[model samples]
Target: MTAVWRKSPQDFGDALNIRETVFVKEQGFANEFDETDKTCDHLILYDGEKAVGCARIFPDGEAGWHIGRVAVLPEYRGKGLGARLLCEAEKRVLELGGKMLCLSAQMQAEGFYKKLGYRTVSEPYLDEHCPHVRMEKIL
Candidate 1:
């Protein structure tokens, strides 16, 4: 079975480990760690005792929240964990009185996000040396 939970301050190490493995070690993203992490809300997914997915949501300086740094360990892809993480993030946003949620999705994952009801709001662009597009969904 799998479970998702909001990470406590002390639980950050597990979340960071997953992100570092997926975003930096596997995907070659430079500066994968950022200052914003200290302020953003983080979610982590676990399959039994193993942490397999992670994502973060931060206030967008507006009425909605921005979701980013979503990552699922390589072995855990194709198992719907990404969708679970996103859904959990959206739930948190609504609980926090947010009206919508947005994310900068990598080009390759655009279809996946679309399948979850997110609509593209921007043209494709480069970020972290990869193609990305802005997408959003109303909660």
Candidate 2:
């Protein structure tokens, strides 16, 4: 079974390891690890003992939450893990009393977020050298 949960300090390494493998190594995101990591609430997704996915969520202004750094290992794709992990993040947002959840979806993955009821709120733009669109969903 796969488990997803908010990462504690000690579990941060595992979350970072997964993010590095997926975002930095696979996607070539130069700034995969950023300043926001220190303050954002992070979620780690593990398949048994192996960490396969991770994401971070933080308050956006006062009424919304932002979800970012969402990634799953390449080998774990097509297994519904990404959607499950994203839902876990959304749960966190709701628990924090956020009215909405938002994220920047890489253009290629826009359809994936759309299926989860997130609507595009911005025109396509470049982020980390990749095309991206801002998306949001009411909580």
TM-score of each: 0.93, 0.93
Task: Please give the lDDT score for candidate 1.
Answer: 0.88
TM-score, cand. 2? 0.93
**RMSD (Å) of each candidate, 1 decimal:** 1.4, 1.3
- True lDDT of residue 111, candidate 1: 97
Residues 1-92 of candidate 2: C-alpha lDDT, one tens digit per residue: 46556545665778889888888888888888777777778888778888888888888888899998888888889999889878888887
lDDT of 2 at 68: 87
In angstroms, the error of model 2 at 74 is 0.7
Instruction: State each model's CA lDDT, in order.
Output: 0.88, 0.85
Residue by residue across 73-99, what tens digits does model 1's lDDT show?
A: 998899888999998899888999999
Cα lDDT for residue 85, candidate 1: 93
Give the candidate number with the greatest lDDT: 1
Clashes of each: 0, 0
Show model 2 residue runs off by greater than 4 Å.
Answer: 7-9
